[model samples]
Target: MRVAALWFPDWPVQAAKLECDDELQEPLVIAAQHRVVVCSQAARAAGIRRGMKVRHAQAAAPELTVIDANPDRDGRMFASLAGSLDDVAASVEVLRPGLVVADLKAAGAFHGGEDVALEMLVDAAARRGIDTLAGAADEIATAVIAARSGQVVPPGESAAYLARQPLAVLTAETALAADADTVKTLGQLGITTLGELAAIPPAAMTTRFGVHGAHIHRIAAAAPDRRVAPELPVADLAVAITPEDPIERVDAAAFAARALAASLHERLKEAGRNCVRLKVVAELETGQRVERVWRTREALTESATADRVRWQLDGWLTSGGAGAITSLILEPLELMAPDAVGELWADRASTDDARRVVERVQSQLGIDAVLQPRLIGGRGVAERIQLVPFGEAAPPVEEKTWPGAIPAPLPARLGGGIDHPASRVTLIDATGKPVIVTAEALLAGEPYALAWGDKKYLLTGWAGPWPVDEGWWASDANRHRVARLQAVGREGGPQGDVTGWLLVWSRRSWRVEAVY
Candidate 1:
């Protein structure tokens, strides 16, 4: 899959300059979450850098003009530029507001050669008063990295070209999907270049960092890239809306655009698919029609699709070439299946259906209303299972070898809480004496019976007292010295089924920790 990438440097700053003409000459910085996300050339010359605190950046450059980052505005402004690229290549994929990529093989053949094809793309962007740096390589990651340096890597030379790049390239906006923390961790481990990262065995990378590591390793090694999958849209999936009132103002157009976007996305989700290319069509009151096609490297979410629609409308209404819009239509020009991989025997369709239901419920209630279980590094069963928001990504588990963690076949159910009445229990010996865990991590006596709430049961079998001594460096309130044992019990009062219980002895008290 030979690919080409076109990058617009300082895009956020340029987008800001387009919004306000006065800031073009000033040392401008775009701030998000009180930090400088991107700084203009002038700001950089004044010693202002990206990721610096906004206050400190302003202090360093007293003449700095700070503009709050607006991603919608950036996408809105870049819509026209992205549209221009369509004239050069038929399959343009926008990675973000500033970065666009496309398959170069077809375009190269039509334009005489790959170099000519790349130059045509740069010329297309330059015609719109935008500076573009273009690069082509055998893979998408290498192409993006090459674009940053304005270098067109020769065929079959992607691996060697990427080897000379710094590890920081992994965290570029258009490069591999690696996070900053992962790159930083690799650098601290003495792997400061792509060559060093690629030299590691793929198995070792996978063992250390799981799937993410394997993906990065493959890209660095210049393995065969996955074929670009593009789907043709079914005409029946298109959605349209005719507002009761003709929309004239940008705010009103934005409202109508959002409604159309949501309706289109719901239809796409119902079909168990995602959109790759979106077509926005507007009908003016004077019977004039205008439309544009927006493409994405990944699936387009509801908000992203809405931003494109809203931006298109804003451009038309604000450009003074069109009147109030009488009707609007959104069409999915291309579609793709969900990217998540499922088990071989798993019902992927049913799983996707259930996820959509959960997302719908979360949208109605709140993001925190639906929680999913994630396993983390911890000694106790309850501490290991962390509940996070349903759609959020699970945090990386750093500690791979937990010395005192409970062994597998983990308990099926955890007790309510430490102080809950249901979690309290009593373990007694044949002499009616309570069984305790000694400081030496030994049991006082063999448990003969168990008293849980209002039921009594005879102990049939039991396992060892797995000792856990954690947080010893902290205060007394934070320290934990407990021993857990798995026991099987039969009901004494009624001839009922045998039940497995996970009991813990801590603070001189017996409590039920989990149920198997």
Candidate 2:
């Protein structure tokens, strides 16, 4: 297959500039995890490179403007660019946010030649104030490499073209790259070019580096390339809803869209397929129709599809150009086998059965009636658990190094609930004075006894006044400055059973937070 690759260099930087109005003339870099992932031409000129520490980049370029890398922002901005390529190619497969590969033969024939087709693609991107490099070769890997320098290899010269490229090209942000260890080992062994790597016997490469070695060797040899899997034809998977009344409000439209999304997903699940692209169609009350195609790098889940539908409807209904929506339809434009992405363990039949049962219950009850507990990032145990509606994706939890989070060996039972009375308790010192956590986060006195309602327990062992100050920036009503203590107590005689208590000192009172 003759494939063509279109690449936008420094895509994250470009996306950031477009979305945030960052000056392209200035030195700019997109940093993630304190390391530079992408840098603009100006920044590169100043000696800032990808994978450099943010601090080091700043030190190299005093005027460097650093923006946090956001994968979603990059993908969102590139969607339009990928969609535009459909005008020139029969089908476009986005390799990443800023790179796309497609079968070049048909487009080349239609546009007179491959060169003209590539030029058209570059021009199309140029029209959008973006610079794009395009290249075509018999193999997708070779074409991607040639795109870096905007060179097109002759139809039968892909092997020759790849032979001259450095082995480092394998690491050029493409799916074809070998792992870092493999590349490093090869470089150490004096295999610094694709030709050198290809010189080794295929069996030798396979024995030495396993599957990855054999794969790259084939690319270097320009063997028959893998066919580009484009978006599948919409088969009969389209699901639609026509509300009895014109859906003018966003809430009502969302309700209908959720049901439609669920139905579409059910059909896909039955077929053992997933969709990467979705086409949302809305027919307005005034006979006007509006539609849009939303694409993702991964298959869209049920919640994600519903969110896109709701967002599309909201935009249409809120705009004065469109009237109330009378009909909504969702169509899966691109389909793939479920395993194309990834799958869970093979022994998940019981899990699937449980999911089906939960879904049936959700259908009978309201969507909100069923809830699932999700672990979130927080300092306290109760704060870390969030209840979300079943079947919907949980909210993304922020990655944080919670410095003062509670230690493990979490309590076996929580102490606060509407149905259960508050397990209010008091901790007293040896002299009978209430134990307190001083402002300095230190225990004022050792806990000697635990008082709960009419029962008093003698404390045998205790630890901590581990303190956590949270939400200090919020209003006083919302701020919390509390301390916790773990204590073991005996209720009756010396032979009585021992119980562990998790106590919290808040609002100048001791309360039972949990029991173990």
Candidate 3:
């Protein structure tokens, strides 16, 4: 496998430098949160190194320009840079702010071989105003080291090339190991050759150096090359945000969400992919992280993304005083081709319109005021319907047509004195005349009289007493409930339009229930 590694050097420091020194091409060092993160090639030449405190770096090169680390800015820039490489590499895997690995076996051929591919990759990075080193090898780890150290070894020679490298080359040296008495540098051990290290008995070595040492020995022997194939094509990208200051309010989640969504959009566009699901992880500065996912057909518009984020933030803020949001991560769960289209035009249009209305209403009233009615299958009218937030996906629609289904035009709501069974009343006219309703009469024609509220009215039409018995399992049982109606002349006169009909009770003291 022809593998290539793109090393960022000190990405955090580089990212910081890109921030303040737009014209900076000279040696620079950047420290953030008091830790030295990067040293420019110039600084390196001047004996300034990464991980050196800003103070020490300055002592080494008094003219060294320093920058503060900003992860968000760095993440965004990294994403943009990654986006630019879509045409060059078959696949791009970002290791951090500054480093990325690209599968260049085929890409090298396409670019006219290894040397050309290396030059093109370097040129691409330079075009983005970022400095990078590219190295190719038969193994990814070897490529990574070559890129870092600017050493190139041909195929079938990786192990031979790595042989002369010291133990430090394996990056296994630690502060404690440096101070320990087993003080043999890999070079000093005469195991400079990877083959020599591989010749060590694995079982015995495990007892001597533990698993990490055995692993390092394997890597030195180039074991990973035999196992590491070209990586699978990446589907989506993710970014996490950790605020410097703790967020005390939930509203912070919204801001974080918006930022993450925008980043996701940029990444998807670069990959030539469209995402249908976005997973948002909002972490409070105080260490509370809540994750939620939203489903959508296209990348959410910036404003819409912000709105949903704001909703989530506000919910958290109002529900509990979360410390500031410390971090936020957005992940794509589902990917579709960038050009894919959907068939639900009408449904999409209506949903979009409804969303707008819901937003407007939520802004006018409190967030809790707007809700979407969800139909459920049950006996209790209240239980049969539920209200959920508008943006949330609606619950599945039930195909339940209960045996004792209510009338065709069921009232949006039902109300009366108190909810109980066995209540009765007589039907009367507008003039308070009682009209007996038999089963036959009920079906024949609309009853003329129905009394309610100490007054009588003519019934233009009548419908169900569709009895609904809810809470069957409860200790207290329910009774039969029915619905009937009454009508009347307008306030103007008989010549005036017929005032809308009203739902009237069927038993003894009739009461008006609804107006149509």
Best by lDDT: 1
Best first by TM-score, ranked: 1, 2, 3
> What C-alpha RMSD separates each model from the true structure?
11.3, 9.6, 23.2
Q: List residue ranges in candidate 2 displaced over 4 A.
A: 19-25, 31-35, 51-59, 66-73, 83-87, 175-191, 196-218, 226-266, 274-516
lDDT of 3 by residue, 1-516 (tens): 777777766666566555545576566766765657666778889887667788887788787777666555565455445545656775555444566666677778898888787777777776334567777788766777678776667878888877766555554322111212122444566665556666778776667655445666666676655212222345648776677665555445556666766666667667766555455566765665655444442344444455544554454444344445666677766666633233435543335344544554443343567777788765434446777876565646758666644334444444443333322334544555555444442423334554334443444445443333344666553444343443443333334344444343344334444444
Q: lDDT per model, in order? A: 0.79, 0.77, 0.56
Candidate 1 Cα outliers beyond 4 Å, as residue runs? 21-23, 127-130, 226-229, 232-238, 242-249, 268-300, 312-516
506 Cα displacement, candidate 3 (Å): 71
C-alpha displacement of 416 in model 1, angstroms?
15
Candidates in order, TM-scores: namely 0.60, 0.56, 0.42
State the lDDT of candidate 1 residue by residue for 1-516, as single tens digits. Answer: 689889889898887777664435578899987899998877999999989999999899888888888877887777656666667787776666788787798788888988888888888877333457888889877888889888889998988998998888887754366645556768889998899999999999988876668878887888887433244546578899888899999999889887887788778778977877787788999998767666664567776677888887886777666799999999887778776544534542344345655654553345688899998768778988899998785757786787867788988998987667788899999999988999899989988999998888998899979988888999999998888998998987346679888888877888888899
lDDT of 2 by residue, 220-247 (tens): 7887865664445567999988899999
RMSD of candidate 2 to true structure, Å: 9.6
The TM-score obtained by model 2 is 0.56
lDDT of 3: 0.56
